[model samples]
Structure formats: C-alpha cells, structure tokens
Target chain A: MHAILDADYLCHLGFIRDGAPVVLPTLYARVAERLYMHGSAGSRPLRCAGEDTGIAVCLTVTHVDGLVLARSAIHHAINYRSVVVHGVARQVTDPAERSTALNALINHIVPGRAADSRPANAKELAATAVVALDLNEVSAKVRTGDPNDDPEDLALPHWTGVLPVQRTYGTPVPAGDLDPSVTVPGYLTQR
Target chain B: MHAILDADYLCHLGFIRDGAPVVLPTLYARVAERLYMHGSAGSRPLRCAGEDTGIAVCLTVTHVDGLVLARSAIHHAINYRSVVVHGVARQVTDPAERSTALNALINHIVPGRAADSRPANAKELAATAVVALDLNEVSAKVRTGDPNDDPEDLALPHWTGVLPVQRTYGTPVPAGDLDPSVTVPGYLTQR
Candidate 1:
C-alpha cells in the first residue's frame, strides 16, 4: 500500500455532495499511516470536512501499467496497481501538522523540493485547506502478467499480448522569468 | 470533452454505496454523448444501477499533462485535462445496445481492435453487466502553461518550470500460449 501510494502524487477523491456522489482529481501526499490532500479553502469537500463530523471519503490512486489483449473480448483486461482508502477525512487545523503535510505534498512531487523552494507564507496558508485521512482501512490491488485466455481460444488466430504502458518525463521547460544562472536541480534530472 | 474521453480508456467511477461515496477505477468508453462501462453482474455499482431508477454516479477521466513547479509551495500546481460527468447511470438490457456498448468499450482501448478480437459468447455476455450514462451534465476542466508564481517570488533562487509528462507504449509481449504465427497487429503497432 505504501509503495503504490508513494508512486503517484495525484488521486481521485470521492465524497457525497447534496445526496449525489462527486469525484474530483486532486493532489495528494502520503505520510506514514495518513494521507493528506489540499485544495482551496472554499472548495466543497473542504467545507464539508470542517463540519461537526468529517466527511466520509473514498480516496483512490491508480497506475495503469499495461493493456492486456486476449483472443476474446470478454477476457481483455488492464494491468494496474491501485490503492483505495475508505475513511472520514478531517480538516487539519493544527499549525504544526498542517506545515508537515504541506511540506510532504511538495516533496511528494519532486524529492528534496520542499527545502529548495520557498515555504508558504501565513497569508498563503490561510487560503488553503488541508484534509487528512488515516490509512487504517486501506487496501492495495494489483494485476500483472499476461492476458488470460481460454485453452480452446489459444488457436483462434488472434494476437494476444500485453501492451506495456509507462509514464515518461520530457525535458523540463524553464519558466520565462527564471534567471539563466539557476541551473536545473539534481533531484529533477536524476528522476 | 470527446477528445479527452477518447484519449484514455481507464476512468475513476464514483457512486453512492450505503450512504457513503465509493470510487473505483474501471474501463470506460465514450460514444457520442453517452458513456459506457461494464463489470461483473454481481458488482455493487452494477447491481445498484440495475435497481429501480438506476444509481447516481460521478464518472471522471483525467490526463496529467505536466507538473508545474513554482518558487513558492502554495503556487505549485498540476497541468491536466479532466472531464467530469454527473448523472444517473442505468443498466442496459437491450441486446443491441449491449453489443454496441461492448464493442465501443473494446475499440476505445485500441481503435480497430473490436474487429480483430472474437466476440463474446452468450454465456460471457450473461455474466457481464453494462451501464450507460448520458453526458447531459458534463464539464471539462483544463490547466496549462507555466506555473503561477508571485513576481516577488520569481527571483527567490529556486527552479521553476513545467515538467512534461506523457504516456508511452512499449513493444507488445505476446502471451505464452499465443501462436507464433500470429504476428503483432497493425492497430497495436501503429499507435
């Protein structure tokens, strides 16, 4: 579960809003047994979490590793690694905990980034809402290897294989206002 | 919205379960203004949608374009294209609609794939459940360009830029039982 959660920094957060289910993609970071996600202070999920009882949420992170093609359409599948957490997310009001969660979110994107970048100011922090969900009811599911085909269908004259899908990073395009002297950091290049 | 939905086959589906929101990653295909997804007949969401008036769901598809790094932690963001659909998904019982939905699901993964693979048998179709949601209440949100950093923070001696992220496909690995004579299909290689 830890490995799957740490592999990606983005997740889909689901919560009920006005008797309807709402799913939104947001940035997330994992710290030990807790998962933290932040958004604008005025966001619906954040506001609901701040109520008397925190909102019940189901946070999921999925990594599509490959496409499994089989001889039959019914047998086709996708190779993926996913982690799902079911819990009630509460607003992080403590100053120390909020600071740690914010730093973790930054570092989660690019390792060692929190130290290299400027920390959030008081005004900036005030405009953000951070929520925490404990990883107690977390489960990790994975699907790998070849496509599953029936023995009778093996000779059906159809191509059966796994199309490996991977996430690749291209050259970093520097900001227009960046100074020429500021070279690309080792953490960014080494990844 | 059509282009974004057609670019990816996997989606995070959210629906209310026991008064709590549950998000699960599943395969989806978009045909015109309707979205189709399928799973086992016994699945919770499928069973719920098969009930009286169907089930309210929020289906979302997100493509992470790049990582935006800013001088300040608060300004960091992700460049992405996302489509969210909020509606009631009902189970499809008509044989014709089910067949079309299944074909769309296969072709959505790889164009021209449905023709190459064998069609599902009667028993296979009986065990599967297909659901369709009209794209009536749909919204597409996108974020692009450079990171938004304050003018004062631009010269803070920190690296700021956009790290482009793309999905790449590797060579197809054939299944062990696949006949050696069945070469890789053009549809898979062309992509």
Candidate 2:
C-alpha cells in the first residue's frame, strides 16, 4: 500500500473506443478507495468518460528500481514495483466531490500543496473535468534483490549485479518573471 | 524523433482482446522505423500479436521532468515529455530479425550490454516472443519551463516555481552469489 501511495502520481490509462484500444499517460490521485484523473473538458479520454455507458479502463503505475543483470540474456530483467487497477470510469459532475478530488490530486503530487495554492474558482472548475474510478480488482506486484542466474552460467565469467535507478529533486527553478523577493517554501525542501 | 529514441525503453502497451482492452508495461526497442516489444512466449499481448489479423495497439513512453507549482490550484501541472504511437502490432517470426530485435531491446536499456551478456540459446529463443510495430503514426508532446498562472493569481503571495525532477544511477550492488573477483564494468560508470 505504501508503494501505491509513495510512487509517482503519473499513470498509463487504457480504454477501448471505436473498436480500438487507446492508451494515454495522465496524472492520477488516490483518495481512499477511489482514484481520480483530471483534464480539460476537451481531452479525448475525459470525453469518453462522459459517454452514456461508462468506460472500462485500466490504470497502471510502475517504478523501476534497478536493472537485473544476469550471465545469460534470457534471465536479464528489471526489479520494479507496479500497481494495476481495473474499473469503470465515470465523469465526476458534482461540484463538491470535484473540489475534493482535485485537491487530492494536487496534494498527492506535493503534500501540503493544496493548502498553499489557491482553490479553483467557479469558471476554472467548470472548465476542468474529473473522472472517478473505484479501486476494485486492483493488484500490486514487486520484484527486488539481485539477478537470479543458472548454476551453470554463474561460472561463465560475466559481471552480474543490479544497477540501481533513483529519482531525486534538483534545485527549484523560479519562473523568469517571479518576484525575486519570494523565497523557496519549506515543503519544497522536504524531498 | 529524438524523444522516441532517447526515452526509457519501458512502455505501456494497450490492445483489445475479446472485446476488452488490456494494457501492460513491457520492454521495447526502436530500430529505424520500427518499434519492437519483447516478452515471454505466453504473455497475453505477445499472444495477441500472433493472430492472423494484426492487433491494434497503442504504445506510450513518458518522462516527467518537474512539478509545476502555480498560485492557483487549477493551474498546477507537470512538465513532461511523452510519445504515443498508434499502430497494428504483429509477431516477428523471422529468426534473424528476432535476434536483431532482441539485441536492440537489450542494448536500449544499457549500451554494450548485449555484447557482454551471452546471447539467447536456441531453447531460450523458442520461449521468447517479439512484437513489431511500424512507427507510422506517432506524436510527441512536451511541457517545460515554469508554471502558467493567471495574471491575477500571480500576485497571490504563494510560491510559484518549478521543482525539477531528476533521475540518477546509484552505485551498483553485486549479486550475493556473484564471483568475488568480478568487478563493475566501465559501461555502468558512464551513467
């Protein structure tokens, strides 16, 4: 569960439309047992959510931790943690839930961000669209540790190990026109 | 074109099967005008590619670069570079091409890795599958720079800037069972 919450908020969402499969990468936030995805009113996936019959969608998030190098190419792999959720997505039309869901999305990316940022105004809320999916039929998979090699190949004189992949935050780059008097916030330094 | 070539080799592939859409994350390679995805012979997406009629698929890769913090929550966004390809995928049956594709896939993740590791044996080749898709319909979208905030909200006394996201390679961890004499290769240090 911590993997699901701590991993990046980006996800790949897939659904069928017009007899063909379509997939897009989008931002997503989980609030309790529900997940919400947001976009402008004109986005194709968001439009599909508004169809009379809700869209059946699959959303997935993955974190590649390291490359598992083995003596044989056949056994080479990546150690990763991933989550997959299958559900029917419907457009969120209620104003209150939309605000809450949007806030969750914002905070999920950066904790305490929702309180610092100004809430959306009525016009902005009307232009933005949110889709909600119940987190049912969800599964998480994780792989770790070093490469698994066959006994015979272990003596084949090849380097074997894990090249760890890591993500970090660099210095904050201010907007070109931002006021120079403004200082970086405390929340941004936590990461 | 560079975006497609430089992105991480992992991608989310989407395809329709039995009137339902399925999506999965897999390793992929780009050789000239074609993109190839690899997996075990029994994988569902690879199996779908073996059908008489090619399977319609969408493949996507994304790199999130920053958190776009805005004065208003509605304007908050992520800076990212992404590529999406829509095409029909077919199983690669030619043995020579399969071998080349497999090598490309391996090298895409780590340069010179294919040359260092043992090539797949005949038995291993028989148990692996490769799917190829032409890079005909592909589009890349990128967002960079600072947050986009409304003029009114720019003066809202909230921090506004971009928290740059970065990925780095950490020290390699050798397999517990690796030979004590084996050393980390120079290729791993280039990262």
Candidate 3:
C-alpha cells in the first residue's frame, strides 16, 4: 500500500455534495499512516473538511500498467495497480503539522525539492487548506500477466497479448524567467 | 471533452454507497455524448445502476501532462487535462445497445481491436453488466504552460520548470497459450 501510494502524487478524491457524489483530481502525499492533501481554502472538499466532524471521503490512486487484449472481447482487461482509502478527512490547523504536510506535498512531486524551493509564507499558507486522512481503511489491488482467453477461443484467428504501458519523463524545460546560471538540480535529473 | 475522454480508457467512477461516496477505477469508453462502462453483474455500482431510477455518479478521467515546479512551494502545480461528468447512470439491457457498448469498450482500449477479437458469448454477456452515463453535465479542466512563480521570488536561487509526463507503449508480449503463428496484429503494433 505504501509503495503504491508513494509511486504517484495524483489522486481522485470523492465526497458527497448536496446529496450527490463529486469526484475531483488533486495532488496528495503519504506521510507514515496518514495521507495529506492541499487545495484552495474555499474548495468544496476543503470547506467540508473544516466542518465540526470533518467529511467522509474516498481517495483513490490508479496506475494503468498494460492493456490486456484477449481472443474474446469478454476477456479483454487492463493490468493496473490501484489504492483506495475510505475515511473521514479533517482539516489540519496545527502550525507544525501544516508545515510538515506542505513540505511533504512539495517533495512528493520531486524528491529533495522542498529544501531547494522557497517555503510558503504566512499569507500563502493562509490561502491554502490542508486535509489529512488516516490510512486505516486502505486497500491495494493489482492485476498483471497476459490476457485471459477461453480455451475454446484460443484457436480463433486473433492476437492475444499484453500491451505494456509506461509513464516516461521527458527532458525538463526550464521556466522562461529562470536564471541561466541556476542549472537543473540533481534531484530533478536523477528522477 | 471528447479528446480528453478518447485519450484514456481508465476512469475513476464515484457513486453514493450507504450514504458515503465510493470511488472505483474502471474501464470506460465514450461514444458520442454517452459514456459506457462494464463490470461484473454483482458489483455494487452495477447493481445500484440497475435500480429503477438508476444511480447518480460522477465519472472523471485525468491525464497528468507534466509536473510543475515553482520557486515557491505555494505556487507549485501540476499540468493536466481532466473531464468530470455528473449524471445518473442507468444499466443498458437492450441486446443491441449492450453489444455496441461492449464493442466500444474494447475498441476504446485499442483501436480496431473489437473486430479482431471474438464477440462475447451468451453466458459471458449475462455475467457482465453495462452502464451508460449521458455526457450532459460534463466539464473539462486543463492546465498547461510553465510554473507560475511570484515575481519577487523569481530571484530566489531555485530551479523552476515543467517536467513533461507521457504515457508510452512498450513491445507487446503474447500470452503463453497463444498460437505462435498468430503474430502481433497491426492495430496493436501501430498504436
């Protein structure tokens, strides 16, 4: 579960709004047994988390590893790794914990990035909202290997295989206003 | 919206379950203004959609285009394209529509794949449940370009840029039981 959660920083957060379900894609970071997510202070999820008892949320992260193509359409599937967490998310108000979460959010995207970047000032922190959800009710599911085709369909004139999908990083492009002397950091290049 | 939905086959589906939001990652295909998804007949969402009035769902698809690194932690962001659909998803029972939806699901994963694969048998179709969500309340949100750092913080000795993220396909691996003479199909290889 930890490995899958740490592999990606993006997550889909689901929460009920006005008797209907709403799902939004956002950035999240795992810290020990808790997951922290930050968003605009006025965002619906963030506001709901600020309520007295917090808000019930379902957070999920998925990685599509491959496309399974089988001889029969019914057997076609996708190889993937996913983590789902169901819990009540509460707003983080402690100064120390908020600082730690803010740093984690930055480092989650690029390791060692928090130290290299400027920390959020008081005004910036005030505009951002942080919510934490414990990893207690978390579950991870994974599917791998080749396509599963029926025995009778094996002789059908159709290709059966796994098309592997990979997330690749391209050359980093520097910001327009960046100083030429700064140079790309080792953490960014190494990842 | 069409382009974003067409680019990916996996989606995070959110629906109310026991008064709490439950989000699950599943395969989805877009045909015209309707989104079709299939799962086991016993799945919670599938069963709920079979109810008289169907089930309210929020279906979302996201593509992480790049990681945006800023000079200030508060300004850090992600480049992405996402589509969110809020509507009631009803089960598809008509045989013709079910067949079309199944074919769309397979072709959505790999173009021209439905024709190459054998159609589902009667028993297989009976075990599968198909749900169709109209793209009525659909919205697409996209973020691109470089990181947005505060002007005053640009002089801070920090690296700021966009690290591009791309989904790449690797060489296909045939199933162990697949006929050696079948060979890789053009649709799979070309994709």
What i-RMS does each candidate reach, in Å? Answer: 0.7, 0.9, 0.8
Model 1, span B73-121: residue lDDT tens: 8889999999999999999999999999999999999888899989999
How high is each candidate's TM-score? 0.98, 0.97, 0.98
Pairs that collide in candidate 3 are none
Worst 10 residues of 1 chain B by lDDT: B147-156
Clashing pairs in 2: none
Give the per-residue lDDT of model 2 (tens digit) for A26-126. 89998888999999978877888988777899888888889888888988899888888888899999988998999999999999999998998888888
Writing each residue's lDDT as its tens digit, candidate 3 over A62-93 gives: 99899998889999999999999999999999
Q: What docking class should model 1 receive?
A: high
Worst 10 residues of 1 chain A by lDDT: A146-155
Q: Rank the candidates by DockQ, best first.
A: 3, 1, 2
Q: What is the DockQ of each candidate?
A: 0.90, 0.85, 0.90
Share of the reference A-B contacts seen in candidate 2: 0.85
Clashing pairs in 1: none
Better of 1 and 2 by lDDT: 1
